[model samples]
Target: MSALILKDFYVMWKQTKVLLIIILVFSCLPGAFYPTFAVIYAAILPYSAMAYDERSKWDQLAGMLPYADRDIVLGKYLFGYLSIAVAAGLSLVIQTALTLFWERASDNLSPLSTIPLAVCVGVCVLALTLPLMFRFGVEKGRLVMFLIIFLVCGSTGVLTGISSDSLDGGYYLSLALPAAALAAVVLTAVSIPMSLRMYRRRRA
Candidate 1:
């Protein structure tokens, strides 16, 4: 399992430099813009990479190696999570830098706000992606991705309206962050088993 995960990471590292440049560009920009990019980028990276592997028939090749279905599924999930974490870290660094320099000067933004916001964004991304990946595999995950994007945008609009009218920033953060995290966790737990089962059945 560890070796398989390392292999996936190795493959991902080939594109890490490009991804880092993207992160840097997004991070240096103002506001929460980069965090949104990070979430979308992180969610898509694994699916895109896996879709390439599937296209190249790498799963079949991997099966010829000693890896089990669970190993493949779990490794892929871990890779996705790790990618999201790295993206989140880059966004945070950018946010911190901005807050330190710009926010201090303008007194316009809160550094404290970025953490929960980033986490919530990440959770929402994972929650959207995982179940799709489980049900559809990477090839069909694109359609699911589109639907998830629409749902997220619509839901966010509704939430923003509600929060703006009824809830303060802190109140909104207090409720939204934990709810997003819990939903992400539960979705992940459920989706992994489903993905594993699908992988095994397909392989069989």
Candidate 2:
């Protein structure tokens, strides 16, 4: 399992370092966009890993290895989940640091309430995307993933507009964050079995 995770990381490090850096730069922007760091990366990194797998003809290459299909699928899901967690964790640290800086400078601080929302957004994006990629190869699934993301963002926008007038940010976030965490956990568990089945079918 560790070897599988490490393999994916090596693939990511080799292929995605530049893209990661490019995305990280945007994460520094002010306002509610901070969570985009984790969300965007979580949404992308697994697909990037998949592209590598396909390019390497992973089926032929992996057949001789001792690893099981479950391990391969689980490793990819773990990588995606952990990537988002790291991104969300980084955003938390950045938001905390920025809050301190604003206090010291006596500046009007942007609300940190969006941090949780960002975490949720990132997870939801993954919940929608990972299964599609697991069911279809990454290349074929990309369009559907984009459509899901668009609908999600659009739905979120509509919800925000409808509730913005009445609900306090704190109240909304407290509810949303837990729901997001639950959703992430559920989706992650389900994706693992589904991916395993898909991989098994391919092998057959």
lDDT, candidate 1, 94-165, per-residue tens: 766666777452353432354445555555566556655655677766787787566545544444343334
Give the CA lDDT, 0 to 100, for residue 45 in model 1. 62
The TM-score of candidate 1 is 0.78
Q: Between which residue pairs do clashes occur in model 2? A: none
Where in model 2 is the C-alpha error above 4 Å? Answer: 103-111, 148-167
In candidate 2, position 6 carries an lDDT of 87
The regions of model 1 sitting more than 4 angstroms off are 13-20, 103-106, 110-117, 120-124, 151-167
Per-residue CA lDDT of model 2 for 44-126, tens digit only, reads 67778888888888857888999887778877767876776676666666656766786642242322455455555655666
Please state the error at residue 102 of candidate 1 in Å: 2.7
C-alpha-based local distance difference test score of model 1: 0.63
Displacement of residue 194 (Cα, Å) in model 1 is: 1.0
